[model samples]
Target: MAALCGLTSMHKIWDKLFKRGEFTELDVDEEVAGFAELLRERNARRVLDLGCGAGRHILHLSKLGFGVH
Candidate 1:
């Protein structure tokens, strides 16, 4: 999660790689679930999507009710 990530280039790559442009609803849902689960397991109180150039993960985390800083 934010506390564990670098908030660097890797996040930008994730934004592109996880782009939902061509993803189906199920795929998006799965991604959200997976991300949320990871955060939960990490007990992350904050999340920072590294290199969130386009804010993809930022938006996703927000949608998941995370108070991104």
Candidate 2:
């Protein structure tokens, strides 16, 4: 379908940019940090990083030992 093709095209663009490290310095903004704190406080063992983009927060959570997906 056209929508699926559009998504594939977008994915290719995003992948190219990410592979070039264009988003490596993406900020772990206040909201995300707050979420991380909450997870830490609750001793969460797993997290679902929905729409994780370049994976900044996912990587952060993973470093803190959560089973991030």
In Å, residue 43's CA in model 2 sits off its true spot by 2.4
Residue 19 in candidate 1 has what lDDT? 86
Per-candidate TM-score against the hidden true structure? 0.44, 0.70
Best by lDDT: 2
The reply for model 1, stretches above 4 Å from the true place, is 1-32
Best candidate, TM-score: 2
Measured with C-alpha atoms, the lDDT of residue 23 in candidate 1 is 31
lDDT of 2 by residue, 1-69 (tens): 999999999989988998998989857888888998998898889999787477888888788788977
Candidate 2 local lDDT, residue 15: 89
lDDT per residue as tens, model 1, 1-69: 875567776767667766855332333456767978898789886776676355655677877778788
The 0-to-1 C-alpha lDDT of every candidate, in the order given, reads 0.68, 0.86
> Which residue pairs overlap in candidate 2's backbone?
none
lDDT accuracy of residue 51 in candidate 2: 74
